[model samples]
Target: MLEIRGLHAWYGDSHVLHGLAMDIPRGRVVSLLGRNGAGKSATMRTIMGLLGKATGEINCNGVNLLKLRPDQIARKGIALCPEDRGIFPSLTVTENLFLPPVVAAGGMDIASIYALFPNIRERGASRGTQLSGGEQQMLAIARILRTGARLLLLDEPTEGLAPVIVQQIARVIREIKELGYTVLLVEQKAHFVESLADIHYLIENGTIVDRLESAEFAASRDRVERLLAV
Candidate 1:
């Protein structure tokens, strides 16, 4: 549902992405797997128009994303859940869930979001600061789902979470995918990506070095792991 071509972005004088390109098909999970500083997060930022200086093409189903403002980009059926989660510290879970204006018509309602994230439902009255890291992550994802965004840009959703919580997050992602959402995931955990993503893009130095389907990833497991190993 999204296509990026020759995308270059700059944070002030620091040019990060260098001709990055990828394709995200409808209802499939595409992952950008890279080491730290490899521009994975920058790619996400550029797609969402969060970067001030981004060039080249970021097309969402033929809509030129680069020309739009960040809010406008979001209104075009895209939502980002950054590494920090971006939760309001003072807002309760229910309040946070309702904070973002629904950009389109397909967003999950409160009942559906609660059903997908039971933990969040249980903590509906808890403030963001009162939640644990995993709870915060779940809330972040839940909050975005209520925005009616068809494309989700998730940055490091599994990072720093407990194994069980990671599993829960993965389950949620799978459920969303089954429900026809397209995901552009920026992740470092290879095993997690391997299990969840349909195709993987290996990025380094702000460019995609290799692209692998799931079967290819299995065949080249050693090489891919070596590149990902820190």
Candidate 2:
């Protein structure tokens, strides 16, 4: 559903993402695994057109994402849930959920989103500041699901969360995959991605160093660990 080639991005004079290339098939969960400075989040920003200076092809289906503005790219059915879950401190959970405009057809209704995130449903009247980190993360994901975005760019969804919350996040991704949404996952934890991602692309110094299907992961476990180690 998504294809990227020769992608390079810059923030003012600082350059990042050195000719990165990867593909995400429709309805599949693909992961980019890398260290802190490995350009994982940069790639996500570039794809979403949030990066200022980017060159190269970011094709979604037949549409050229590089030519479109961030809002336009979103209207074409792509959504980014950044590492920091962007919830409004003053808004209630229900208000936050209804804030983003629906960009396309076939978005999940409030009932469906509520069903997927029962915790959120239970706390519909609570302000964002009243929620726990896990609840906030769930709301972030839920907010985008209402936008009818087919391709989800989840940047480090599991970062800094407790083990149980991480598992819940994983489960949510799995459920969305089963529902036919394509996902581009950026994560540092290979273990967190093991059972969820269909393909894993290891990145180093802003480029792809290796690609592994889920089947090859068992054999490449040690190599993946070494590369991820600080």
Candidate 3:
């Protein structure tokens, strides 16, 4: 559902991505794995049109994403749950949940999102800043669901959560897949990706160094370890 070709992005004069290319098919989960500063986040930013200087094509569902503004790209059915969870600290949970509906098509109903995340339902009236790290992450995901985006660009969704919460988040992702959404995920936790990803790409120094199917990825533990070990 998404294709990036020969993508090059720079922060001022400091170039990051160099001729990076990849494709994500409809209804599949693809993981972008790399160490810190490997340009995984930068790739996500570029795709979302958040970067100041980027050259290349980001096509989603046969439309050119690079030509559009960030809000326009989002309106075309791509939602990003960033690494920091990007929650509005002062907004109540219910308010945050309702925020994305303004930009989303068919709008995610409260009941459906509640069913997907019961924890959020329990904390519906609490302010964003009052939630725990895991709760904040859940809120982030729930917010995106409200958008009803067909393609989800999730960056480090499990970054700082506890094991149980991470597992819960993984289950939610599986549920999202069952609901027929395509996901492009950037994750630092290798094991998390192992269980959830259909395909994997090893990104280093702003480029994709290796791409493998899920089975092949699982069998090559040493290769994954060597590439990501810091």
lDDT of 1 by residue, 1-230 (tens): 88889999999999999999899998999989998899988999998899989899988867879999999988888999999999999999989989999987888988989889998989999999999999999999998999999999999999999999999999999999999999998988888988899999999999999999977888877877887788
Query: If the candidates were sorted by their TM-score against the true structure, best first, what order would they fall in?
Result: 2, 1, 3
lDDT of each: 0.91, 0.92, 0.89
**What TM-score fits each model?**
0.98, 0.98, 0.97
Compose the digit string of candidate 2's lDDT tens values, residues 97-120.
999999978888988898899999
**Tens digit per residue, CA lDDT, model 3, 72-110:** 988887888999898999999989887766575765678
The model with the greater TM-score, 1 or 3, is 1
Q: Which ten-residue region of model 2 has the weakest summed lDDT? A: 55-64
Candidate 3 ranges with C-alpha deviation above 4 Å: none
What is the TM-score of candidate 3? 0.97
* Model 1 residue 17 lDDT score: 93
